[model samples]
Target: MKITDMTSECIGKCLNYLSFDDLLRAAISNKKLNNAANLIYEQKYRSKRVEMHILSRLHSNYFMTENRFCFYSLRTSFQFLFCFGRQVNEIHISYIPRYVIPGENGVQNENNVELTHRAIDYANDYCAESLRTIKFTRIQDASRYMKRPFINLENLEFYDCNFTDLVEYNLLNALFPKVQKLVLKTINKNLDQPCTLKFIEGRFAHLKSLHIESNSYSKFHHADEYCILKGNLVTAFRLNPQLKELDLDLFVNCHVFQSNDVLLVINYLQNLDSLSLAIDDTFCSLLDSSVPPLMYFRNLKKFSLNMQLSTESRAIQFTSHQLDTFELHGVDRFTNYEYEFLEKHPTITKLILRGGHFERLNLSRIAAALPILEQLMIFDHFKLKIEEIVPHWSKFQSLKLLCFFHTKIVKDSDLKPLLINGWHGRFCNSPNKFQIILKR
Candidate 1:
């Protein structure tokens, strides 16, 4: 069959898998393909308004908006949105700086406070009221501006934001009153400063998730500073009692990341369904073997704990009965207690171990404990006795993917247990249901 003669359903499916650039080229190839593309893309943004970034880049996954059509090159690919049927959305102001616009119409320049404001104005005057999310990147300080709220924005994210941008902007409950999720991230490796959380502008009582991942080498470790930061977090969590996930731990060595104190404070959030905490030896010191460290989170489902730098033999217990995923980093002899914990929760399907030296632990023991585990990832770890898993091969029929990243096996034959299993497949060398992937 000729490619152009295919039905729009098949053409739409084909376009769906194409890369953004390729999809554009295909959409412009012929009339039928363009119609199929319009039908497919329109369904995606039917209820939700089109995503228009006031700034430079929009992720490839985002649907093209009329604002994006301002760039001349894509004028052809996204021409479907400009068809005579839909009324064109107007650009907020006629006088935007030449540097802020992308492509030939504008010159690429540094993002500053003024440019950020222009982007805000674009959104404030945006004809579409369903614009639900906004991301501010490399913005220094937008605390001052037209001071209008994005009435419908539900998720607000700031990447490499100014140190006090959120604090100064204060997430004014009025500006983003309906925001359910707020994310703050800093890839600035050299941000060696201290900032407080206590002085944030407004108490957003309706938040469902708050993720802050700043790896700054914080200088606020004094006793008074610690007390204040801890109290501030507790109060924030209290207000956002519906918070489901709080992922403040990304960089293990970030001094600003309050480990021991955060571990103690987060216990008050009982409804948390997912949690990630990157702690060190100090947090381990607070763990009591008799009582699980995470006893308070009754509804917890997915939990990740990175022990970063701990050499001593410590035992930490988890009490979440609904846990579906567990990731542990910097494992030592203490992981024996983790195995004990998983033994009680056989429903866990994913287990990830990273940058750890397992002296007395066995891979098969983990499989033996959690028989239903489907995905197992081990990254940057010492050599493992994967051959030892042969005894528990029967228990792992439910397993699907086993990945070893930068972690070497003892020898070539060590993989025989996972591969070439006769019970799950026809041949010993070729298994059908499971896979063993090795990464360097």
Candidate 2:
């Protein structure tokens, strides 16, 4: 029905599916509909207090109030409590100028001291008592704001802010006091040109999940070097005892510590059930042959490692008897040592192998080792002697998804039964169909 014919019941149902903005637009065309929709939107989607600031107003009299609805500052802080309006549950502030690097186009970049204070005030006033998740940004010096620790925030994220310098220690120390999930991005590994493990022990003690990514690969490498010398990486694993998931990718050339050093750091992270480790040649070589004593991650389910495997040495040696889902990259040369390693534990059900020459691979040996293997992915061209083990393929009857890329033997005639029953994935030789053949 048209707007005139529609009743309040019809409008309420319609607005339920429309976003606040869309509903507002629809209401503007009809006063009765607008009045009814406004009430519902405010009751459901609208926050009791909404605050937005483009600049700090810390010096202004507006912030002096003991309790207020919304407080925002581009200079200082809007000091207000949430009691005035349910404790300002959501606060969003952006500092885009800090992103403009100092020397870029000769822009003289200086610290926005006033703005920094304003940000800390918002976090303290809005998030200290009742806020659920507060996202803070444009923090040139997160350290100063994070010092007092009045926050009970559950989720915290920092963009283009450095949190590792001694100057910022108080800031990190303050932020993670009660935060459950913490994320950092596009920030300096070295706050002031020197590498620092800014949050190893002081911050994130209560963190359950941690995710860090560098905007530039080179900068991340710079951070890795700092972590190694200061033992920051090791200390991080030890500090977050309650941490359950970790995703870290270092960009710079990492310093290769002894295997014991690596184990010393990882063993402390026994609580980690989902782990993703992405290292380059320098770091992977360190873990080549040495296997860290598996700390009991009884709940461990998914484990992935993306690092270069040195032909001279195995890139990583994982000996977890509990690991179920496994993905490895840069592991080819199927040496006897690598083969024996897998033979010892064949319980893994899913496997993904990337970037390796399998010319030396023994199909029979692999099938014997992992009799229960179900899903396999090989993403690289390798010389495979499939003819040798065609008859023994019965062992792989349990296989479900098999993928081959750029292999020498695409359609081996002897492998007919396995192809029809299992889902065969391969590159199509023509646009019409995938180039896969079965044995007669």
Candidate 3:
């Protein structure tokens, strides 16, 4: 049975079983294998997602034949788009300064601005119809390219980008009127002059998700910055009234947000299915207050709360009958009342508890509360004997996966109960779903 005597289907099946690197190595062995490898490579990567970093110099022949390319540089990106525009679906452009000093005689260089304009013109001319998403990072003059229309672009993300003024910020709404998802992170270099979201005046009618975050941590910001951020947030809520999912991690300190402001924002969001809020102790106090009821978020199916400070009085209530996923982080302790809240929300099938202090009793309470939980992740500050907690495992009727990170197991017999109960255990492992991690 010589290799060449095998049928084409058998040979292909053999090649398909080989890893990509092995296939390339086999290609070097013979002409028949080389042809097969080329066919496989093209079939695998031709229409796959492509990312190209176009920083320094332009290479003429570099990505002329690739498809679905995500370009990072300005001039080279424009050239690549000019050549293979129809094949591209996503593009990322980051401005790389060529000068030794950023500013010349107190005025920033305009050459980068001009290059950006040219890139925008190229994108508009060549790939406007096929492009689906565009991301701009570390951009100085964002308004220059943002003023142009991207006909079919559905997603836009900005990271560490600068917007000089409110007018430039508003130009984003005008640039991609049909955009469905928008993500903005660290939008300003000067914390004193943070990009204001107050000007976002309901421009995106089709937007389904909006994510906004600041570069500065909540504890380090000044009073004035918090004031501006809060005002801008209120304005954002008013502008995008039809959003279905909102992720806000801007204000790290709860003191920055008043109880009424929190109520106003949550109440304004009518049909949201998912909400993620990262706040400090003061905001948690507001949730425990009577004014803004938890009923405001009763329609959410997925909810995440990342607390900044540890407090025993922390209370949060979710009356959402449809909520199937719940995540809580950075809280030190879960009181009996809080556990009771969880017991009421049996609809939650996926629960993630991170950075919380939990003993055997607390773990038992959690297992008893959410009997229908399918996926559970407990990371950091969880100290208990596995044998002591296993007695409560019978309560988890629907659990399929369990994970522990940086957890301490006090006794060797801690895992003996799990092995007896048909649960697999793994220690110091990597990337396996059915394994339970224990740190002795």
Candidate 4:
């Protein structure tokens, strides 16, 4: 039999036993073996091309044949990747100036402004042929570059990129007019105000997920000016009517706490299936609020909130029917009012609490509130009164995967009783149903 045929038969029979490295080693014996290996590893050809590119940088002496290396130069790895997928489903492209420096030797940078048209043509060709999800980040001028319409592209993401003005946003409305998922993350929040509003009206009319984050890594001269425009997430959501999930992180400035803009966001996204927020300390209204009457994401399952500034208290009231996983971080204290709100929810299956230093928490009351919580994580340093928490161990009957790390309570003998009671013969008895880990 031919070497390719023999290799294919062997792979079919012994794929579980032979690793990719083993196959490569076997194929390096002769020309017949090389051909057989190429056929077997064709799906990973781009990765192999990138490996050769990195090797060329590290060791100038190394070289590969045309078949081993992609047709484009090392600078156009993404370009080569674009051509490889015959049925393109998703295309995510991002540019960071540092990563796209001109080649030192004789190679040209394919990502330069002059060559971007060629890249767009490549993208257009693929999208025209098949359904595509196109996501771009750090494109210097997206509104001008992405002027043409795409027929088969369904989802679009623009992150930390530059755009000219509302005129450029008109171009986005023209392109991908049927986008079902829209995400925009930008540094110059003012530059694309109209573009953002237009997107909610044009493309995101039926958006399934809408995510927006501020590129606040850069310092601004007037720190407070961008707070209203940048931090007002409610304004962004109000523009969209059919959004199912929203993940927003906005700066908390003096004007953000109970602003009308925030009310607009809460009103629009009240029915989201998943929500994630990282906000500043100025917004204390986050602690206590009933679920919006118009919004009941009967399917809303995951929620995470990371408070950037230390707040005296925090609380959240939510329905337990669809909530299975929850995570809360960076709050100093959970007030009695907050605890009482959580006490009402008895069906959360997984929970995580991190960076908490409060010592006055009522452990028994907290445990009694959550009847179905299975996985619990109290990570990174948490100081608690062991005596107060240890006695309430029996309340958690369905408990599993308790991760309490970097805490003074880990060394206490009082915790041993709860540990033994919660985990003793339970894993074998429950069979991967329960586990507790203590890290200091």
Index of the highest-lDDT prediction: 3
Whole-model lDDT for model 2 versus the true structure?
0.55
| Candidate 2 lDDT, 359-406, residue by residue in tens | 655667767888787776666544344454456667675666665543
Q: What RMSD value applies to candidate 1?
A: 9.4
Q: What is the lDDT of residue 215 in candidate 1?
A: 66
C-alpha positional error of residue 49 in candidate 4 after TM-score superposition, expressed in Å: 13
Model 2 regions lying over 4 Å from their true place:
1-139, 142-160, 164-167, 171-173, 185-195, 203-206, 212-229, 256-258, 279-300, 309-311, 357-361, 380-393, 406-419, 422-440
* Model 3 TM-score, 2 decimals: 0.73
Task: Give lDDT: candidate 1, residue 22.
Answer: 66
Name the 10 consecutive residues with the lowest summed lDDT in model 3: 56-65
The CA lDDT at 383 in model 4 is 46
Q: Of the pair 2 and 4, which is ahead by TM-score?
A: 4
Clash pairs for candidate 1: 420-428
List lDDT for all candidates, in order.
Answer: 0.57, 0.55, 0.65, 0.53
Alpha-carbon RMSD, each predicted model: 9.4, 9.7, 9.4, 8.7
- TM values, all candidates: 0.66, 0.60, 0.73, 0.64
Question: How much is the lDDT of residue 228 in candidate 4?
Answer: 35
Ranking by lDDT: 3, 1, 2, 4
Q: Kindly list the per-residue Cα lDDT of model 3 for residues 271-321, writing each as its tens digit.
A: 788988877666656676575466456578898887776556355654577
Better of 1 and 3 by lDDT: 3
- Cα lDDT for residue 11, candidate 2: 71
Error (Å) of candidate 3 at residue 329 is 0.9
